[model samples]
Target: MTSLFDPLALGDLTLKNRLIMAPLTRMRSQQPGNVPWELNAEYYAQRASAGLIISEATQIAPLGQGYPGTPGIHTGEQVAGWRQVTDAVHRAEGLIFLQLWHVGRISHSSFHPDEGLPVAPSAVKPSGEVLIADWTMAPYETPRALETVEIPEVIAEYAAAARRAKEAGFDGVEVHGANGYLLDQFLQDGSNRRTDAYGGSIENRARLLLEVVDAVVGVWGRERVGVRLSPYGTFNDMHDSDPVALFTHVLGKLSDRGIAYVHMIEPRATSAGGGDTVQEGVPCSSELFHPLFDGVFISAGGYDRDGALEAVASGRADAIAFGRAFIANPDLPERLQKNAPLNPYDRSTFYGGDARGYTDYPALG
Candidate 1:
């Protein structure tokens, strides 16, 4: 049986451990430009012991911005800024991947140009609020539906963002298709009520996500591309009546593409923002859909050391990605190896904060 401490091959790269760092949005990037800076570099460098680090959900364009201070990869300055982060991680012998994101309808007009409404697959207002600058909360605005012809443009944007991730010195790119983001909006039925080629049936709903994966693969090839999905997640007010069928079909399509891996959120992840919305008795774990895909599978959400070890040992997942544990324990893998006590994370400073809960969390001595 493969232990969490053993190295595993993830596409073209080999991770030293199976404790991958899930993408976490700290909202500490530089203002106005929304670029990663030296502080961001230090933040990631401290936790470089993970098997892999997936950078926080980074917007591909200005219109994709949902919250303030989240980083972007669409500009020369932003790419240059991320170079520092990649360099820091690489210096610690850590592999890093950037997560390409677009918030879709889970956004406010304040972050938009001319205060325009955010765009989505359809005009649906999510039942939640978004954080702007300085941790200010605002209700979500009804988003403008994207025109059919403009779909190709958004696909191209993902391709461009993938190229920029390479330019920023990342080892790979994970398309953020989870957490009710743009691609998830198109993937789920609740947010997507369109009559075009991009909605209605399971195949249509999955069209945008596959197109995005294809577009990014065109730039980075299949080996350096991965995708994240939340099959039973209700975050940002997202839901699909037949999540198992929907995700199985989508994962099957991704298998044909030969992507590096599929990072899936567990059903327990649905409690975010409000309460659980996943139907009872539903098969939502990644283990149920493992055979449908031909690549590595990463299971995330509320995983502890024993749980993570069991998942990999039982062949349920090839790896496990930890979120909050990683936030408080920079040397998470090391601490887990010895079963050492972990530092508690301050929830108040989770978003839009300085180095307090961002980088000052000390690793186990």
Candidate 2:
């Protein structure tokens, strides 16, 4: 039986264990530039025991930003800021990957350059409120559909961000195509109602994501690039007429590309008031799509130690990613290894806060 603690080959690097730190948006970057600072460095360094730490969702360009204080990889200052984080993680003997992201229709105009409307594959308004630059709730506005010619610009932005991640000294990059964000908005039929080559059929809808993946792979070879997907995700009101068909095609395409790994968000994570419960009768991404992906497969969302062990041992997933658990337990791997009780995380300081909840979680003595 494969143990979660066993070393596994993930692309060119051998992860010491299969416990990955999922990319979490803390929204604590410095204002004005949205650059990561020393505080962010300390937070990541404290979790160095994770097999791999996927940094918070980072916008690829100014227009790509959706939330206040989320970091970016587009500017020199942003790159420099991330360098501090990468350096600290490396000094702590940890490997980290920057998750390249762009939240399309998830944004309010205040976060866009020139206060322009957020862009998506179609002019659809999501059914939720977004946190604007001022941290106020604003209803999602109908986003501008991207001109066919404008898509190349989006692909280029991803490539550029991958290069910046490399310059920032990250070991690799994970394209953020999950959570009903820009790429997810393009993947599902409910949000992407386009007549052009970028939408319509499954192949067309998946075009942007694959193209973005290829572009990032160009910067960092296939071994160093991974993609995150949320097949049955309901967050941000995402849905599809045929999720299995859409994700099957997407997974098969990714397997053919031979990328490093595919990280998937289990449906249970998006459930109301989030917990470890899997929605009854909904097939898990690992159970449904794991066999389709030839390379490494990582499953995230609501996994306890026993469940993680079962998934890995049964070949349901190659690894498990922990989000909230890692927040309150910096030495989560060690704690799990010994079955030590985990410190409960404070929900109040989850987003945009100081060192109190960020780095104050005491490790096992």
* Maximum-lDDT candidate: 2
TM-score of each: 0.96, 0.98
Instruction: Please provide, for model 1 over 109-219, each residue's C-alpha lDDT reduced to its tens digit, 9 standing for 90 to 100.
Output: 777658489999999999867786446888888899999999999999999999999999999999999999999999999999999999999999999999999999999
Per-residue CA lDDT of model 2 for 250-288, tens digit only, reads 999999999999999888777522444557566688999
lDDT of 2: 0.92
Angstrom error of the Cα, residue 185, model 1: value is 0.6
Off by over 4 Å in 2: 113-115, 271-278
Structure candidate 2, residue pairs in collision: none
Model 1 clashing residue pairs (backbone):
none
After superposing all C-alphas onto the true structure, candidate 2 shows an RMSD in angstroms of 1.3
Provide the RMSD of all predictions against the true structure, rounded to 1 decimal. 2.0, 1.3
